[model samples]
Target: MDTMKRLGGDAFAPQTTYLNSASTGLIPAAGVAAMHEGVQATAAGRPLDHFRDVEAARAAFARLAGVPARQVATGASVAVYAGLIAASLPDGAEVLLSEDDFSSLVNPFHSRPGLKVRTVALEDLADSVRPGTDLVAFSQVQSADGRIAAVDAVREAARAHGARTLVDASQSAGWLPLPQADFLVAVGFKWLMGPRGITYLVVPEDLGGLTPLLAGWVAGEQPWDSCYGPVAELAHSARRFDISPSLYSYAGAVAGFELLDHLGIAAVRAHDAALADRFRAGLAELGHTPVHAPGSAIVSVPGLGARQPQLSAAGIEVSDRAGNLRASFHLYNSSDDVDRLLHSLT
Candidate 1:
C-alpha cells in the first residue's frame, strides 16, 4: 500500500527523463533486480524456480486486469498474441477492424488463410457491424491520433452481430479503464513498465474452446511431462496461447505489475491524463494544433517535422508520424517534462 516503495520510484527517478511509456516503459530497479535473480536462478540449476516466478507474474497481471489467473497468457510480443486471436476463428472468417488500428493488430489477420479483413473508421464502427462478422479487433486508443475509442459501444455492436471482440490495449492498458471484451491483448513493455518480449492476452472463459494454432510444448495440457507425445491437448485456459516459459521476462513483468498495483491504476490514470492535458495546453499555446483536440497520454501535434530538429537538438524525444509529432507521457512524467518539451518547440 505504500505507493513509493511498491512502485519503485527511486529506480525510475534516476533514469532518463522518460516520458514515452507508450513506446517502451521505463523499467524500475525492482524489475531489473528480479530479472537478474531469475537469470541467476536459471544458471544455478534452479530453472523450476523460475517457472514459479512466471506463474506468479501471470497471477499478478490477472489481478490488475480483474480476471482469473488462468485467463491470462503471456506471449513473446503483441504480434504473437494477436496471432493467437486470429487463429481462434474458423479459416477465412471475416475480421472487422478499424482502419486506424495498429499494424500489429491487422497483420495477423492478413497472414491467416481465408481470413477477410474489413476496415472501418473509428466513428463509423457502430454502424459497420454486420451479422456475418466473425472477429472485431481494434485498439482502445488509436496509436496515431491517440483518440480514445468508444470501446463499450464497439463491444455491444460486435456482440449484436455475433462477433468476438479483440481489444488491442497497447496504448491504454495502464492509463484508462478497459471495457470488457471477448479478448484483450497488451504488451508489457508499454504502459506496464516491464521489459519487452512479454505480452498478455485475456480470453473469456466461455470462448475457451477456441483452438490455439501456434501450439507449443509449454502450452500442452501436461506441461511438466517430459514424455513427448502428439502435441498435448491445448489448455482450456488462456495459457493455451503461451508457447514457452519466459521466466526472466515474466519475473520483470511481475515487478512491473507490483509497481503498478502499488500506485493504483486510478492514480496512474489521473496522472497520465493530467500530464497529457498539460502537454496539450502547452502545444496549443505554442501555435501547434493536435490531431485529436483532447488527447490521452499519446498526443499528436501537427507540424512535427518543422519542430523535430530543434527538439532533437534539445534532447527532447518525440515520435514523428506523417506530419504529426507524437508526445507520449506516463506516470513518471511531471508537469516539468511538459514544460521542457514546450520550451524545445520554441
Candidate 2:
C-alpha cells in the first residue's frame, strides 16, 4: 500500500473529502483505538500508567521537534504556553510579532501589561527586529493562509539583536522540519493528527527563565510524593513547566506520534506540498489566484469564501478565513482530492 494509505487510509470513510487540516487533522484509527483503550482502563479502575503515555508522547514530540526530552513541557494549549512566556518577560520588554499571526500567538502578549508589543507584516518580521527587541514571536507556518515564515532570517536577526524567539508550529509540525527556537509550542490536534487537549512546549536549557505559573502536582520532582502539598522541589528541567496531562489525549497523541515516526516528516511534507501545488496550478487555470506561498501545503483563494457552503454541500471540506477559501493538504490527501476541489470550484 502507499505510505499515506498505510498510515491513514482506514481513518476516513470511503468517499470522505477532508482538506481542512489547517483547521483540525483527522485522528488516525490507531489514535482512536488508543484513546478507547485508555477510557476502558479508566472505567475498569485498572492500574494504568497514564503518565507513561505522557512521557512517551513527550519524548516523541521532542524527537520530532529536534529538542531534548528534558526540554519539552507537555501542556493543554498554545495560549497557556504563550502566557507562560509572557509572564517570564520583564515589564516594558519589547516584543515583535506578525500583525496577522494567529490570535493565540498574538493575544497573550497584549494581555501582559507594560510590554511593548510591535506588529509588522509577516514579510517584514526579520527586518523589524531591533536592538531593543527582547523577544520575537510568530507562527512557523501561518494558519490564516499557510505562508511559511523565513525562519532562518528571523533566527539570524534575533541572534544578532540578542533577542529570544517563540515559534508556534501548530500549523506546521508533523510535516515541516521545524527550526530551533528559544520557545516553541505546537498543539497536537492540527497536522499532528492527535486528539485535542494535548500541546507541547520546547523551552531553552535554562527553562527560558520562565516561572511555572500553572504548575500542578505533575511539575514536582517527585509528582506522587508531592501530592497534597507544594512541590518539594520543582523539576530541574522544562518538566517543571508542565501542566497536568489530559491522559486519554496523551494516549491518542502517542499513537499519532508513532504513525508520524514511521512515515517521517520529509516524506509527509513532499506528499502534502505536491497536492497543494497541483491545486494552485488548477486555481490559476480557473482564474482564481490563491495566496502566494511557495513550498507550502495550504492554498487560500481570496473572494471565494462564499463558495465554501456550496463546496461543503457537495461533500468537500475546507475553511473560509477572512473572505478567503482555504484548503490545506495533508499526508493523506492526494492529487485526486486536489482535482476534485478544482472541479467543484469550476
Q: Find the candidate with the highest TM-score and give its number.
A: 2
Off by over 4 Å in 1: 1-8, 41-48, 293-295, 305-310
Off-target runs (Cα >4 Å) in candidate 2 are 1-7, 11-15
Across 238-274, the per-residue lDDT of candidate 2 in tens digits comes to 9998888889888888777887888789888878887
Candidates in order, TM-scores: namely 0.91, 0.97
Q: What are the lDDT figures for the candidates, one per model? A: 0.76, 0.88
lDDT of 2: 0.88
Q: Which candidate ranks first by lDDT, i.e. highest?
A: 2
